[model samples]
Target: MTLDLDPLRSGLHHRHDRVLIAAVAGGDTAHRTYGAPEAADAEIGSVSKGLTGLLYQDAVDRGEVTPETTLGEALDRPEGAYAQATLGSLATHASGLPPQPPYGGPRTMLRRTWRMWRHGENPYGDSVDQLLDEAADVRLGKPRFVYSNLGFALLGAALARTAGTSYERLLLARVAEPLGMTGVSVPSTPRCLGPTALTGRSKGGRPHEPWTGEAIGPAGGVRATAADLAALLGGLIERRAPGISALDPAADAPGASRIGAAWLTTRTGDASVTWHNGRTGGFASWVGVDRDAGVGLALVSATAASLDRDGFAGLARLRAEADRC
Candidate 1:
């Protein structure tokens, strides 16, 4: 069956800044853009967690770790909440970890917000050591589907430590390089950003800080173009990416969706759409695939206007449109 691209194209044009939409079917690929077409780098927020989940699965397959391996065994931190949490639980957001670190209190959040608006400060400046220190007092809650950025952060750290490298390098070597995703990266500093990197803005029209740094890279520090993200999604759909099974649904989630390692899965007729979305202070992103339809899509926008909701809606519409084709 043929694939329809008009719905996605129109969707991108209507409600986003510096938008990019990409889709792939079989060996054919297409891209559409609006506003800053040249802006290829935008923060991908928590979608980074999905990629991190893939990396964790790869590590497990290679025997570098195991699903049963506890965070304490992996990170060598035998005390506190993370100690008893397993790698599988962390990747699936079933680790009973909170959403953020204890140090991210109200006062710290306010300061971070101020810095974001005033100085474009990188809110995630704390090093991995600092993150672990801050997490020392954290108490694990009942194990269920609680999305935890801190859980992903610690998972990435443990994986990196197991490989004796950083998360950025690990992602580059294992995922990006393998998939030819040259545009996917974690910028070390603001100065390292590309010329076309998007400037993230706040809801109040003020420019906010770009989310970067090592501590948060695993949770939400990726930057990539629509083309790159489309390729990644296609790779997963075609089973060209290692550990692609990580995208398979493992448990039930909110909104009648199923939770995979880090992806959300929903059904549209006979097609299963597995997706993950991202949002930073200034950018939003969504990537998904309908393997049965041989279609995969990626969307990125420079505006931070809660694109997650819009993205899901758009994808559902796009899926319906594709069905008609």
Candidate 2:
């Protein structure tokens, strides 16, 4: 059975400046575009973390590192809260790290938001070194299923250090290049300034810069097209990616879902849906796979508002429809 994505297409156009939706089922692929051409790139936000998880697992497969490898050992840093955290813990969001660094207080966040909306400033300006410095004093709490961007940033950094390369290079070599996801990349500058990049907007309707820089790249910095995302998801579903173990359940998350190296899985009827959603200052993205149905889907929008609710609802419905086929 073919999937009808018209409702998703309409909703995306109404809520975003540009949108891309793609789906793959039984080896047949299809897509819909609105307000943007298929090649236009949009930030994938935290969805990048899911890719980072793939990279980490690839490293594990090569024996470059192990899931039990501690962050301190991988990064060669002195022992501390973050150092004691294992790679598996970080990937599963059980490292006890906070959602963000402590330096950005409420006032700072407000100022950054204003600058982003008014001047199109890239709010994540800290360099990797600077991020490490900020993370030095972070007091980790007890390990649990707490989502932490800082933890992911550290995980990406550790993975890169283990391979003696940069995160972007590692990802490109191990994941993007292998999967034929040519449009997936970490932009060195504000993507909003690029000709093929879509203009992003704040939820309040103010134009904002597309996310850039390496500070948040691992946690949420990927810019990609719908085709690239569909290819990546398809690779995961087909077991073509090297780190297929990343999709295996690692820990429990909220709502009875299982977390597996940044991918979250929840039962939808007799099938399981593994998915991740992302949002940045000017973009939102969602990617999911219904393994039982042999289907994958990706949605990207040029908007800052969270698309988690709509994305989950749509993907669940799509999965149900695919099952009926």
Candidate 3:
């Protein structure tokens, strides 16, 4: 099924910007976009962590690792920063970590993460040394929702270690390739960003970076086309409510709560959906699927919201359309 989504068409219609919507359900795929580009690909951001969590689960289903795997042991680091954290804790965002790094620039973010792992505040740091230091010095409360990028980043590292390969390799071999998502990548495939706020032709803006490659691979670096993301939604939705649950802050923490990985899980009547949206400087995208109702949806926009919930609203509308379909 393609999509019965004309009502939810580009709420923001303009020149030089766009939105794409794709859906799969009852054995069909359909997609549409505004400002569509032949090479329109952008990062899924923290949604990458959720995909990493799903990959970790896939590993468990394949008997590669158990949910009980200690963070340190899982990554083969006995005294690492996140050593005391467990796989479940990381997956659930109960590991005490700050939301974003102390800094904003990607390079600065990496440096600050290392510092927190070493000497600064331990909350948002992402380096091995900084994490080890923080892990030794700080202890998170049991089962409390901490919503942390550091937590998910550690989980990504653990996944790489479990797969005995790079995070990029694991993402490609286990996810993108298997699903025929050549347009999807944890490490971007020929990544580049245009000069615009969500794809506008704004002048004087800098050309954006390609998400930090392997550096942010697990956290927020997966780039994908709208159609490719719809395929991923298809897979996740098709496999929903099974022995697997994607790491979603909205799902793990409900009621418009602030949580890590910034994903949302909403249940409508008998149907439950897990979803997320992504943005770089110039593009935005959303992808989601319902486990029980067999519905999936994808949306991408060149122009984005300063707030990210627009994507969620789009998906909600998609679900609403499905009610009629």
Clashes of each: 0, 0, 12
Spell out the clash pairs found in candidate 1: none
Q: Whose TM-score is higher: candidate 1's or candidate 3's?
A: 1
Over 4 Å off, model 1? 1-7, 12-15, 37-39, 104-107, 110-121, 313-325
- Looking at model 3, residue 81 earns an lDDT score of 45
* Per-candidate TM-score against the hidden true structure: 0.90, 0.91, 0.74
lDDT-wise, the better of 1 and 3 is: 1
Q: How far is candidate 2 from the true structure (C-alpha RMSD, Å)?
A: 2.5
TM-score of 1: 0.90
Off by over 4 Å in 2: 1-4, 11-13, 79-81, 104-120, 191-194, 320-324
Residues 1-325, model 2: lDDT tens digits: 6656677676654667578888877566777667888688788889999999899888898999988999889988875457888998999988889888655555365587577777777777667877787688789898888899889989998999889988888899999989988877786566324577777787777677767777688899888887787788788889888687888888899998998889999886677889898888777888888876788888888877777766767776776666666
lDDT of 3 at 209: 33
| Candidate topping TM-score | 2
- CA-RMSD of model 3: 6.2
Q: Which should have the higher TM-score, number 2 or number 3?
A: 2
Worst 10 residues of 1 by lDDT: 8-17
For all predictions, the C-alpha RMSD in Å is 2.6, 2.5, 6.2
Best lDDT among the predictions, by candidate number: 2
